[model samples]
Target chain A: MNKPKHKKLTCLGIESTAHTFGSSLVSLDEENQGTIISDSRSVYQPPPGSGIHPREAYQHHSDVCSGVLIESLRKAKMDMDSVDVIAYAGGPGLGPCLRVGAVVARSLAAYYHKPIIAANHAIGHIELACMLTRATNPIVLLVSGGHTAILAFSNGRWRFFGETLDITIGQLLDQFGRAAGYASPSGAIIERCASKSEEYLLLPYTLKGNDPSFSGMLTSAKRLLSSGKNMDDICFSIQETAFSNLCEVTERALAFTEHDEVLLTGGVAANTRLQEMLTEMCRSRGSTFRVIPRQFSGDCGAQIAWVGLLSYLHGMRLDISKSIVRQSWRLDQVDILWRH
Target chain B: METLIRKGAEADIYKVRWNGLLAIKKIRLPKGYRQPSLDAELRKRRTIHEATLISAAKLAGVNSPLLYYLDKSNYSIYMEHFDGPRIKDVLDDPDLGTTKIFEAVGRSIGSLHREDIIHGDLTTSNFILISDGCLGIIDFGLSFRSNRLEDKAVDLHLVKQTLESAHSAVADEMFTDLIDGYRSISGDESTNRIKSVMRQVQRRGRYARSV
Candidate 1:
C-alpha cells in the first residue's frame, strides 16, 4: 500500500547496480519537478583485459556505499534526519551489486523512520531526464550496455516502439574497445578513434524493422582487429553501422508515436556521435531532440532519487521487507504512475 | 527536381524523373545527431545495402520495386514506383477479398526468407498490390542478410503481431492463410523452425512482462 501523496518531499536513493555504487539526494525544484541535490559515486575500474568481476564490484559497493552516502548528505547540506524517505535501485541489475545498495538503503530507511521505495533503474533514467529537460511523453532512446530500446510513455505505461533483437550497441562498442586493448567503458575512446577514420571497412549491417542485431557486426569488427586492420577505420565502421541502426529504429518509433520530441538517455547516450545522429534524425523529422547531460547520462543514484520522488508523489511504496532486488526487470513492466 | 512523396524517419521517398523515366528516389538522409563524417558513411552504406537487397529479393522470386539507379554520393536510389493501393488499405476494405492478397504476401515473404533476406518491415502497409495483382514489397530500410532461423521466425512474429494489432478484424484469417501459402513454397524444416522460434519469441514477451 502507498502512503498519501507528498508534494514537497526529499528522497535519498542508493544505486549499486553494476560497477558503480553511489547515493543521491533529490528535492522538488520551483517547477514542482524532481531535481538532483547531490550525487556521490565510486566506480570499480578493473585491470585491462580482465573486465569487471561481479563479486569484486559488489565488494566495492559494500565498502564505498557508506562513504558515498555521507558525502551525498554533505553535498545536499542536510543531515541524516532531514531526509523524508529512502529508495534504491531494486531490480533489473547485477544481483550482488544490487544487494549492496538494497541493504544500505534499508538500513538508512529504518534508521530515519522513512518509507522505503523500490525503483526501476530504467524508469529512473527516463524520469530524471524528463525532470531536467521538461520533456512530456517524448520517445526515449535508451542505449546502454544493459539496455537498448525505443520507449514511449502512454496511458501510464512505457511502450516499446522498437528494441534490440540481439546484443546492444553499447556492448558491441565496449567489446570492440576491449579487443583494441582499451580499458572498460571504452566507448568514448573508441569514438575519438573513430573520428580519425576516413576509410570504411565492410561489416554486416543488421537493422531489421526498427530492431537491430549487433553480434554479426561485432564479430566482423573483432575479426578486422585480429587481422591487423586499421583501428580507427574499424571504430568508425562500428559507430557508423551501430548508431545508424539505433537512429533508424528511433526514427521509426517517432513516426509511430508521432511524438514531437526525443530524449536520449543511458550510458551510451553520452556518446557525441550518437547525439549528432539522433539530433540529425530529429531535426529532419521536425521534432525536438534532448540529450541528458553527460553527468546524468550514465547510471547513477541521482536518477533513482528523482524517480523515487516522482513515484512517491504518485502514491507508490515499497515495504522494507518486500524490497528484494530484481536482476531482470524490463522497462515495460513498470506502471509509470508518476507520468500523466 | 524531386517531389516528396513521403518522408520517414530514416529516409525520404521522393517522386523524381530519372532520365525521363517515372522513378521514385529513396534518399537516406544525413543524421545531424551523428558526426558528419560518420553520418555520411552511414547514409551511403544504407543506400548501397538497400539497393543490393532489392536485387536479392527479386532474385529469390519476390515481386518488388526494381532499382534503376543509385547515387552513393548523395545517398539516393532511384527505383520503379508502383501506383497501387497498399495491402493495408485493401485489407481494411470489407468489399475486397483479402485471402488472395494475403496468400501472395506469404509467398513473397517465404521466398525472401528462403534467400536469407529478412524484409525487416513486414507490416501490410509495406506491401503494395500492383496493377498485375502481384504484391510488391517495399521499404528495405531496416532489412538485413541473415539466414539464421531465429531471424526468420521473428519476421513472421512481427507480421502476425502487426496484423493482430492493426488488422484485428482479419488477423486470424490472414495469419492462417499466410501459413498455408507459406507452406506452398517453403520447406518443412524452415516452417518448423519458424513455429518453434515464434513460440519462444512470444513466450519471451510474456515472461518479460512478469519481470
Candidate 2:
C-alpha cells in the first residue's frame, strides 16, 4: 500500500469527555505519521464513595481548560498559532463535559482561523493504540467507562462485532468499588484487591450471543458483598467473571472474523488481569495481542490529536458555525476515510 | 476416524465416521480465559442445550442437521454431516448467491420463532447450503426457548447485524428478501410487530441510536 504524502502539520487536541480535561499538541512528520509532542491533563476527583456529577466535571473542565492548553503549548515550545488544526472530542460522553471541550476548540479555531475537527471519543482510543502499536486491521476490544465494544475495521468504518448489553466493564468495576466505600474510577484499587484473593465465587456469566451483560453480574457481586462474603473474593470473582465474559465474546469475534491481531485499549485496558486474559486468548489462537500503554490507555488529548491529524489530512473540517458537541455519537458511525 | 473441521468460538467441530456413516462431532473446548469450574459448567450446559435445541428445531419443521449421538461426559455432540458450503461463504458469490436461499433462511427462522424457539446465534455462518439448495441451520450452542417478542426480534437483529457487518455489499437486498420471506410465513401483522420490536431491540444496544 502506498503511503499518503502530506505536508507537515500540527494539531491541538482538547478532551473533556468525562472526568479529565486534557490538551495535547501533535505534529505529523513527512511520512504523514503523527507524533505527540505534548500532552497535559487535569482530572477531577469526586467526593469519596460517589460518582462524578456531570455538572461538577464540566465545571472542573471549565476551570482548568486554559491551564491545560497553555501547559501543552509550553511543553511543546509552540504557541497556538503554530497549530494548523484544532480538534475536540465531540460525543459519546457527558453532555456538559463535551460542551466544555467543544467550546474550547471552537474558540481556538475561530480565533486562529484553523480548521476544527470533531473526533469521536471511542475512535480516539482505538486510533491512538493502532498508531502506537502499528496494528493494521486488527480486532479492537475497547473497554472503558463510556464503552465496551469489540470492533473491527470494515467497509470504510469500524464495525462492532460484540459489546456489553448493559453497563460497561469499567462502570461495573467502578460501581463495585463505590459500594465498597471507595471513590469512582476505582479500577486500579479493584485490581489490587482482586489480585490478593484466589477464591473464585461464581457469578452470573451472561453471554447473549456475542453480547455480554454485566448488570446481572454486578447485582450478584453486590449481593455477595452484602451477604458478608469476603471483599477480596468478591472483587476477584467480579474481575474473573467479567473479564472472562469479555474475552469470550472477543474470542468469538476473532474466530468469526479470522483476524490475526487483537488490540486492547481504553481505560479498563490498564488492568493487568484483563490484559493477561486477552494475552492468553490471543496466544492460544496464535494471534498477536497489543495493549496500549497504561499512560495512554485512558482518555487523553493525544488520542484526539492523532485522530484529528488523520481526519484533517483526509479533508475533515468542522466549520465554526457547525462545531457542536454530540453526547451520544457512536464509534461505528464515524467514516474512517483516512485508512485504506 | 475423526478430522478437525472448524474451531468455533465455544466448540471444536470434527468430521467423523460414526458407524461408517458421515457425521460431525462438536466438542465444546475449554476456554483458558474462564475459571476452570465456570468453564466446565458452561461447556456442559451448552453441549446439552445445543442438542436439545437442534432436536426442537427439527421437530419445529426447520431443516437442521439430524443428531446422531450426544456425549455429556466430554461435552461432544455427533450429528449428521452436510457436505455443503456455509451460507456465509456463498451468500455473495454470483454463481452461488440467490435471493431464494435467503428467503428460505427467513422462512426456516420464522418457523423456529413460531414454535417459540430462538436461535440465539443467527449469523449466516451457522446456515449451510445443502446439496439440494436448502438452507440448513447448524450450531445451536446459544439457542433457547423464548416466547417473548423481544427475544425473537433480537434473533433477527443478529442476522441483520451480521449481514451489514460482513456482507455490506448485498446486505440490503438480502435483508429485504429475507424479510419478505419471513412475512410470508409469519404474516405481515406479526412481521411488522416483530420489526418494530426489533427496532427497539436494536436501539437498546449501547450507542445504538444517534441522539
The docking category that best describes candidate 1 is acceptable
Model 1 lDDT per residue over B1-211, tens place: 7899877777888998888989899888766655566567667766777898988888999987899988867888899988888877787787655456777888888999888898878877788888655789998766789988888888887787556545655778888888877877896777877888887765554115331
Q: Model 1 reaches what TM-score against the true structure?
A: 0.81
Query: Candidate 1, DockQ to 2 decimals?
Result: 0.29
TM-scores of the candidates in the order shown: 0.81, 0.97
Q: For each candidate, report its DockQ versus the true two-chain complex.
A: 0.29, 0.66
Which predicted model would earn the best lDDT?
Answer: 2
DockQ of 2: 0.66
Model 2 clashes, total count: 0
Question: CA shift at B163, candidate 2, in angstroms?
Answer: 1.3
TM-score of chain A of each: 0.96, 0.98
Best by DockQ: 2
lDDT of 1 by residue, A243-307 (tens): 87788778877764457899999999989988987787777788899989999888889988887
